[model samples]
Target: MTRSSNAPLSVVLAGGGSAGHVSPLLAIAHAIKATVPEAAIVAVGTKDGLETRLVPAAGFELAFIDRIPFPRRPSLDLLKLPMRMSRAIATAKSILRDANADVLVGVGGYVCTPMYLAAKSLGVPIVIHEANTKAGLANKVGARYTTFVGTAFAATQIRHAHLVGMPMRKAVATLDRAAERAAARERLGLDADRPTLIVTGGSLGALRINKAVAASLEALAAAGIQTLHITGKGKAVETASGELLTAPLYQQREYVDGMEDVYAAADLLLCRSGAGTVSEVAAVGLPAVFVPLPIGNGEQARNAAELVAAGAALLVDDASLDAAWIAENVIPLCKDDLRLATMGESAKHLGIRDAAESMAAMVLAASGK
Candidate 1:
């Protein structure tokens, strides 16, 4: 294990529940290390979710707290929320004392509520990073005590919110497009001359997007467009395809670890409009057809609208996502080089690649480091 200097400044990162929250936390942690080489960093999250595996892989110590999902409707879980929250706060106090953290950063989730509260009680500085266009329930409550607020969306509900944008990992944000495209296609054994379409449904994959693309496969192939599909865990490309168009035209996998390659090799993308997805697409300058996940009060749809208004992408409502519409609207964009190039250029202009560094600087200032 690597050790920092005695009396080194310490920070505790608290968040989880999805990759959307955890990935940005990881990016800020990386930026902190780069900017303040002597700083000590640790993570706080539940035992469940991707954080259990991801935090350790990123070479940071992780402290697990009690799991708490925000109650959608009042129930036994809601009744137990107060008790669980008390216990989680106590756990956070113990972890904070052990790590000797001088400041706490909440990345937005139920796990963050207790940690932020504990930090407030201890008189340690607290900061929050909100990734949604509208504030999430956890962040909204935590914002009252937070010293600084940062967000991917420019106009969020947080009172002191700053438009920092979402922070992507250094590897993905700084990938060389020309080199990555060549290497990624070579690795996937795809044709260099053909226009390629890359489709993904985020980390867990979207059933709606998957099914629509599967139904439109014949039409896409007929238009001479090859594809690279990341199907998550639910569906498989082998099961979706019979025997035709196997080689040099189609590549499918449950997940693509090489996202840089996926972005580089694709002429266009069909994806969900989550904060992380939108930010990455903007940073990479890719033309995309966004199908927002229709949940809650249509927050994803709102996010998609922001990009479409900026000419960065095209939005397709989840209710209207059929094979015919997919073929008609999305296939043409892939085939039309001039339109594709224009959209890609507009998308790239929306990226704020320095967001992580800006957020880290705020954390440092708040900590009086």
Candidate 2:
């Protein structure tokens, strides 16, 4: 790797087809900046993904690469994979050269493959951070040339992987439970005395989680439980709000700027089991019912199982997520104060709050910062 005397310790962070990938990269970027104040970080992503908006908003520069979707079924996209990959590699290499990045970190996404290959060609020491229990294809390929690999799950298949857990945003890391609860409730105009359930399906929102929770709004209200739902953007929040408006104690929101308060105010969580979500829930010591996304590599299922086995959370299949089932088996947990506390305590046992620090240290080691 070439380094200039005047340049700061530079890093190229790759990955971002979805929020699942982008959020962790941002978290890591923040951590690196916090730990090594002079470090210069640049994100490598496509123009299409959330990173285009999120990276800049996070106060980092993002360099664009050609779009390269992970091949699913056989189609024209698969046929064009070779050309797309070639262009992506070229784009990544140019960005690396332009930025004078000292090290490359790949956060598992299809866009990462080319970035990793380009970095390897430049003889830059590479690190891969896989946020799922199962390694994504990009991370799996990136791992072969990488000196260090980190994962949210200890059980990830990549060799030489460090079980550092998922890196959470600094905002999440700094949450104060009691203060968060009061502030979150007051901000949302929710009653502080009532039991509150917070339901979310990641940043983009989960349609299945939204539908099931929306259908159960009446039941939740009847059971004397208040609700805070974060539907993904583009979802019809008005439609969901209209359904909840018919009930006595329900709130529907498209998004919240301060998620820490949401976690703080929540008596329980109903959501999907993305790695970042799992880490945040556990970090905040919140009890949850996890419904893993049915698609992808079953990583969400694996993440949920780890918590479920620890008695930190409950796992419900998406197929069985009707209102009746949630009401019958899940709703009662909201009423059990002792059980909720116990679950929260257990969840805290699964949290690695220092994950960001560990990841930052790893990056520093890889980059010789």
Per TM-score, the best of the predicted structures is: 1
Over 210-235, each residue of candidate 2 has an lDDT whose tens digit, in order, gives 78877898888889998888886766
Cα RMSD for candidate 1?
Answer: 2.3
Which stretches of candidate 2 lie above 4 Å from their native place?
1-5, 70-75, 237-245
Pairs that clash in candidate 2: none
| TM-score of candidate 2 on Cα atoms, chains taken together | 0.93
What RMSD does model 2 have?
2.4
Q: How do the residues 1-369 of candidate 1 rate in per-residue lDDT, one tens digit apiece?
A: 123458467989999878988999999999998998778898988888789999999998888899777687989999998898899889988888877887888888878888888888998898889998889887887789865999898867787898998888887788666668877887876788788899998888888887777778888888898988888875664453453224346667888886778888888989989989888888888888998888877778776666798888999888798898978888888989899888988988887787888889888988988
lDDT, candidates in the order shown = 0.83, 0.84
**Each prediction's TM-score versus the true structure:** 0.94, 0.93
Counted clashes in each candidate structure: 0, 0
Look at candidate 1 and tell me the lDDT of residue 78: 90
